[model samples]
Every structure is written in C-alpha cells, then in structure tokens.
Target: MFTRADLGKDERLDLMEFTLVLEHLGLSWTRAETQDRFEKADANLDGFISYAEYRAILEAQGWV
Candidate 1:
C-alpha cells in the first residue's frame, strides 16, 4: 500500500499521493478531512508521510 501510494517512488507520500491511499481504502473523506488527517499523520511535520508514519496512523485508526 505504501509503495502504491508513493507514486513519486521517493519512499514517502505527498498530499496528492496520500489522497490516492484514501481512495485505495475506499474512503470518501472530504478534501478538508483528508488534509486534517494528513497533517495528523505526518508525525515529524516533514510534509510527507513516511512508511512508519503511515503505519502509525493505520494503527491509531484500527485499520491495521
């Protein structure tokens, strides 16, 4: 999932790639909702979602 979501193939997900991840999960979050969640998921405040960060988010949301 991370690989697929990392459309840039840079080993991290930008906002656009993260949106693709939500779509892959069949989530229909509003743009604002996604942005909010994305901000929360970016633990390091690095402006991208690392694999560790993504996993943490999934765990927090009980999705993993």
Candidate 2:
C-alpha cells in the first residue's frame, strides 16, 4: 500500500502521496486530520514518511 502511494519512488511519502493512501483505504480525512496523522507518522518531522515510519504507524494503529 505504501509502495503504491510512493509516486516519487524515493522510499518515502510526501503529504500528497499519503493523502492518496488514505483515499485508497476508503478514508476521507479533512486536511487538518491528514496533516495531524502525517505529523505523527513522520517521527522525525523531516517532511516525509519513511517505510519504517509508515509501518510503525500502521502497527501502532493496529492496522497491520
């Protein structure tokens, strides 16, 4: 799922790509909600979610 959203193929996801992942999951988050989730998943706050961060969030959310 993360791989599919990684349009840049940089092994990380930007805000837009993350949003698409949410959409793909049939989730409809407001901009603020999306940002908030992104911020939490981006443990380092480096403006991108690495695969480790992504998987961590999923595991934390009990979605994996």
Candidate 3:
C-alpha cells in the first residue's frame, strides 16, 4: 500500500498520493474528507506521510 501510494517514490505520501491510498483501500471521499484523513494520518505533521504514519493510519482506521 505504501509503495503504491508513494507515487513520487520519495518515501512519503503527499496529499495527492494519500488520496490514491484511500482509493486503493476502496474508499471514496470528498476532498474535505480526504484531506481530513490525510492530516490525521500525518502524525508528525511533516506535510507528508511516511511509511510509519501510513501504517499507523491503516491500523487506527482498521484498514489494515
């Protein structure tokens, strides 16, 4: 999931990549909802989601 979502291959997920992550998990959300989820997942508030952050969100949201 992380690998696929990291479209830039930069080892992190920006908002755009995060949206794709949601889609990969069979989730459809509005821009607001998607941004909200992405913000929540970015635990460190680094403006990007690292693999750890991604995993944390997956587990937290029961997507794992």
TM-scores for all candidates: the values are: 0.95, 0.94, 0.89
lDDT of 3 by residue, 5-45 (tens): 78899999999998987888788999999999889888899
Q: Least lDDT summed over 10 consecutive residues: which range in candidate 2? A: 55-64
Q: What lDDT would candidate 2 get against the real structure?
A: 0.94
Question: Tens-digit lDDT track for model 2 on 1-64?
Answer: 9999999999999999999999998999899999999998999989999999999978887998
Best by TM-score: 1
On lDDT, the stronger of 1 and 3 is 1
Show the colliding residue pairs in model 2: none
Rank by lDDT (best first): 1, 2, 3
**What digit string (tens of lDDT, one per residue) describes model 1 on residues 1-64?**
9998787899999999999999999999999999999999999999999999999989988998
- The number of residue pairs in model 1 that clash at the backbone is 0
lDDT of 1: 0.94
lDDT at position 6, candidate 2: 99
